[model samples]
Target: MILWFTIVQIAVACAAGLFCLIAGLIGRRPSDYTVGSLLLVELLLLAQVVIGIVAPLTGNPPTGDLLEFWVYLIAAVLLPIGGIAWALLERGRWSTVVLGVVAISLAIMLWRMQVIWTVQVA
Candidate 1:
């Protein structure tokens, strides 16, 4: 439930999304650079996952529905992985577009996760 970490994750997702979208617009297929950039995001998400898991155990559970927060975290971790898998198989600019869409979705998921974490306890 660290707010700054979630904010950084959102920023990274949006930046990655824009990068992939620009690559698609320029007629470039998914490449090492795209995957590498996504890999960074994936790594950050892994850290987030670890944090999410540990926080609850250490007395910092989300203020809202913990189940929903976990679901969002799972989805956030999977999106980049699925996108990379698709790109590897498709090997086209369309794959880049797909990745861009996934990255944008990841951003939304991060935002949702933050909201879930910060909901007022009642």
Candidate 2:
């Protein structure tokens, strides 16, 4: 729940989402670009997972409910996996759109997680 890392994650997710949405709107099917962007997002999430685990040990624990933070984090990690699987299996323009939607959704979820980690603790 590092503020700088969370901000980077949000920005990356939004950029990836916008890219996929634009590509889908242009009638592009799921390609390496679309999938790779999502993979990048997924990688960031994985890093976040690790950070979430180690941060508390390093004296940066969340102020909010720990369970709530973990739940949001777990869900955030899953979203990209689900989206990428759907895009690969379906291989359609709509699948790309779905990826975009997932990315945007992930960004929103990350925001909530940040709130729970910092703002809601008090």
Best by the TM-score measure: 2
**TM per prediction:** 0.94, 0.97
Worst 10 residues of 1 by lDDT: 113-122
Q: Using alpha carbons, what is the TM-score of model 1? A: 0.94
Checking candidate 1 for backbone clashes, the offending pairs are none
Candidate 2 structure quality by residue, lDDT tens digits, 1-122: 89999999999999999999999989899999999999999999999999999999999889899999899999999999999999989988999999999999999999999999888845
Query: Each candidate's lDDT (Cα)?
Result: 0.88, 0.93
**Candidate 2 stretches greater than 4 Å from native:** none
Q: Write down the lDDT that model 1 would get.
A: 0.88
